[model samples]
Target: MTEHDALIFLVALATLLGMARLLGEVARAFGMPLVVGELIAGVLLGPTVLGRALPDVFQWLFRQSTPQKMLGAYTTVGVVLLLVVAGLEVDLGIVRRRGRSAAFTSLLGMILPLAGGILLGFMLPDSDMKNPNQRLLFALFIGVALSISALPVIAKTLLDLGLFKTDLGLLVMSAAMIDDSVGWVAFSMLVGPMQGNSVEFHKLLTMGGLSLVFVAGTLTAGRRGIDRLLTRFADELHGGRVLSLVILLALIGAAITQALGIHAVLGGFVVGVAIGDSPSLREQTRATIHEFVTNVFAPVFFASLGLKVDFIHAFDFRLCALVFAVASVAKVLGCSVGARAGGLGWRESIAVGFGLNARGAMEIILALLALEAGLLKEQLFVALVVMALCTSLLGGPAMKRLLYRAQEEDVVALLRRGGFVARLNATTSRGAIEELVQILEPRLGHLAAHARNQVLEREQMAPTGLGDEVAVPHAAIEGLEEPMLALGLSSDGIDFDAPDGKPATIVFLLLLAPRRLDEEVRVLASIARSVIDPRAREQLMEARETEQVLKVLAESAQRIAEERRARGPALADI
Candidate 1:
C-alpha cells in the first residue's frame, strides 16, 4: 500500500472508532443496545445513504478494493476474537450442575423453533426463480434460523438486567451455551450436503478425532506451554509484546480451525476458553483484546453488515411478518413448555421463555452462513435479520416485567405464611454496627441515655469486600425493640479491611430481636447473597435518594424470595 493509502486507512480507522464510541454512548443513554447504534452508524456511512449522496467524497474516504478488503479482513479477525472472549466468559460447569434442566430446555427450544420455521416455510408460495427443492432448502434455513439462540447476546442482556448471578440466569446461560454449540454442529451437518461435495464418512470421522485430540492436547500441554511462554515474554518485552503474543495465539488458533473442517471461529473460541482459566492470562488478554478490537475493529464489522443489508431488494412485508411470527412463537412455546415440564410455575415459565428468545450476533452469523450457502434468498435473509433484531431488543423489558410481577406475588405469599416480618433497607454512611445502633437508638436509645445499657453492642469483625469493587459489612447487634434490617451504600467506598483488601462501598446491616434472631440471620444472609451481584451493586450505587435505594432493594429482595419459593417448601420431619 502507498503512503497516502496508509494515511487514509488510519484516518478511516480513527473515524470508525470515534463513531462507534459516540454511538455506543448515545445508545447507553437511551437504554438501547450499543450494537444497535453501531449498526445505525454503519447504515449512515454505507452506499444506501451518505455514499449515494456524495459518491466522490465517499470514494475518497473509504478508498477502493484494497482498503475495503483490508477493513473486511480486520473485521473478520475481530469477530473471531470477540467469539473467543465470549466463549471464555461462559462457565461450562454450570451445564453439568443443571444437567437435566439444561438438556430439557435446550432441546425443547431448538426442536420447537425448528418445527415452527419449517411449517411456516412450507406454507409460503413459490418465488419466481426458486423451485420446490430450493423452497425446501429455504424451509431448512428458516428452521436453522429459528432454532439458533445468541448465547453471547443473552448473556449480556442477563448482566444488564441484574440477573446474571441469579439461579434462573445461570441455568438459562448454561443451557443456551450448550444449545449454541450443538446447533452449530447440527448446522454444519445440514449444510454439508449443500456444499456440492459427497459425504466422506472417513473425513468426517477424521475431523472429529482430530478436533478432540486438538482440544485435549491444548488443555493438557498447550496451556502450560503458553503460560510459561507468556511469563517469559512478560519479563523480556517492554510494551507491545504482551499484545503481540495474544494476537499471535488468536491468529494461530483461527488458522488451525480453518485448516480443519469447522470454521476458524471454533478454534479461536476454544483457545480463549482455555486461556480464560488462567487468571493472569485472562485478565491481561481480555484487557488487551478489548482495547484493540472493541475500540478499533468491531465497528467495521457491524458497518459491513449494515452496508450489505439491501433493504430495498429484500423488503417483503409479508415474508418479514411470517418470519417474525414463527420465530417468536417457536421460542415462547419451546421454552415455556420445557420450563413447565421442569415443574416451574406459569410466571417463571414465561420469564424463561422470553429470556431465551433474545437473538443478536449469532443469528446474524447464521443468516450470513445460509446466504453464502445459497440456501436463503436476499429477501428471506433480511426477514430473518429483522426477526433477530426484534427478539433481542424487546425480550429484556418483557422478561423483567414478568419476573418482577412473579416476585411481588411471592412476597405476598411469604407475608401471609406468618413466619416473616417487615423488610427494610437503611441508607447511611455509618458502618453496619453504628447504623444498626442508630436504627435502634430512636426507640431503645432512651434505655441507655445516661448510663449505657450495653444492650446494643457492635462488632466490626471481618469485612466482605467481594473483589469487583464491592463490600459487605455484617454486625451482631444486641438490644433492639424488634428484629429489623438496614441496608446502606456509600458512593465512596469505605475501608473495612476485606479479605481481598478492598474497601466496602456497600453495607448490609441486620438488626434482630434475640427471640427471632436465627431466622433474621438467615434473611440477612439471603440479602447479602442478593447484594453481592455486580450489576445489583452497580444499581444500588447509582441510586440517588433513600426512596430509590429502598425501591431497588425491595425489588431485589422480592426476586430472591420468589426464586427461593419457586423451589418449593422443604419436606417436614417424618
Candidate 2:
C-alpha cells in the first residue's frame, strides 16, 4: 500500500500488541492459558465489539483496504516464525527415550480422531461445506485439525503440575509431538491440491513427493550443512550473526515449502526439527530465537486469529457444542485407549487423554488455513475456534482432578529404603556421583558398575541440576527390578554445571529399569514437590547425622503429601 495505509497498519499492530499482552496477563492471573486473553483482545478489537459500538473508529483503524493485506503479510510472517519455534521445541531424542508407550499413544491418538473427523465431515449438510465439490479434501482437513495436539499447551500444563521433567510428562509430550508432525504432514498433503477446486490427483502426488524429498533430504544432508554453518558462524562471527542465519534459514525453508505447493509452515517446522535434533545446537542460539519469536511474533499471530472472525454474528451455539463434543470425546477416547493398550492404569490413561486433548495455537493455525482455502465457512470457523478454546481450557483442570487422589500416597517410602548420606565427600558432580555409587555397590552387586556408567552418561547428555541448589541425576538401568533412589547432601555445594549456575547442595540419585519408569516418575514427583519448601531443603542441609537427615526428608515428604490431599497437587502454586 500507500503511505496512509502504512501508518494505519503500524497503528493497528501497536494496538493489537498492547491489547494482546494486557489480556494475556489477565488470563494468566486467573490461572487460564495466556492465549485465551489474547483471543479476547482480538474480539474486542474486531467486528464484534469495536465495529458495532464505534463503526467510524473501527473502520479507520482496520480499514478493509491495502492495510488489511499488509497486516495479513505480517501475520503470515508471524505464523512462519511460530511454527519454526514449535519445530525447534520438538526433541526427537525425547520421543525415543519415552519408548513404546509414546508410539502407541501417538498412533491411536491420530487414527481415532482422524476417523471421527472424517465421519463428521460425511454427516455435515451441504450448506456447511465451503467447497461442495471438494468434499474429500474438506474431510481430510477436518481429520487433521481434530487429530493434532498443541505441544505448547500440554507443556505449560505439565509445568504447572510440576511434571514437565517427569517420565509421565516426557511421555505425553513425546506422543503429542508425534501427533503434531503427523497431522501437519497430513494437512500438507490434503491442502496441497486446493488451488483450482477440482482436486488433481497428479498435482497432489507431485506436491506430496516434493514434500517427502524436501523433508528427507534436509534432515540428512541439509541438516549437516546447517549444523556446520551454525558451528562456524558461532565460533568466528558474533552471536547475533548466528541468530540472523537461523532466521534466514527459516525463511528459506518456508519459501521452499510454499513453492512446493504445501503450506510454508511445514518447511519451517522441518528445518526447526533438524536444527533441534543437531548435537551442535547451542542453548544460547535457541534462546535467541525463542525470545524474539515467543515475545513478539507469537502474541501477534494468535491475536490476529481473533480479528478475522465476527464472534457475535458468526457464533452458532449448536455447531460450537457439536464441534467441541466431537473433538474432545474423540481425542480423550483415542489417547486413553492408546495409553491403556500401552500398559498404563485407568487413572494414568485418563490423565494422558486429558493432557493430549488441549488444542491451542495449532488448531487456530489450521482453522485459519482452512478458512483461507475455502474448506471452512465463517460460522464453522467460529465453531472450530470455540472448540479449540474450550478444549484448551478444560485439559489442565481435568488432569489435576484425575491426579489428585494419586498425590496422597506415600512419596518417600521407596527412597527411605534405598539410603541417605548426610555428608557427601565430593565437591563436583562426577565425584559426588562416584561416592554415592560406591556407597550403593554392596546393595547393587554386579549392576553397580553399569549403573554408575549409565548415570554419568545421562549427565553428559544433559545436566541433571534443577537449580535451587538441588540436582536429580537419574538413569534407566538394565538390571534394576524396581526404582531406587539415594540422597546425598553437600554442605558446601558442588559444581554440576546447572542451568541456574548455582552449585548443587542436594542430590537425588535415581536408577530404574524400563518397566519401572512409571514408578520412577512417582518418586521424582515426590522429591520435586517436597523440595519446593526452602526450609525443608535447609533442614536436610543443616542435619548433622543420617538420622536427622532422614527425619527432615520424611517430614517434608509427609507435609507435601498431606497438602496435596487436602487441597490439590499444585506444586508450582506452593
Model 2: residues with Cα > 4 Å off, grouped in runs: 97-99, 232-242, 282-288, 407-416, 420-432, 453-463, 467-469, 476-482, 489-505, 513-518, 534-544, 547-574
Q: What TM-scores do the predictions have? A: 0.69, 0.89
Residue pairs that clash (backbone atoms under 3 angstroms), model 1: 426-487, 455-479
How much does each candidate deviate from the true structure in C-alpha RMSD?
11.2, 3.2
Per-residue alpha-carbon lDDT of model 2 for 327-414, expressed as tens digits? 9999999999898888888788888999999888889888998888777889999888888888888888888777654443244665
- On lDDT, the leading prediction is 2
lDDT of each: 0.62, 0.81
Instruction: Give the best candidate by TM-score.
Output: 2
What lDDT, from 0 to 1, does candidate 1 have?
A: 0.62
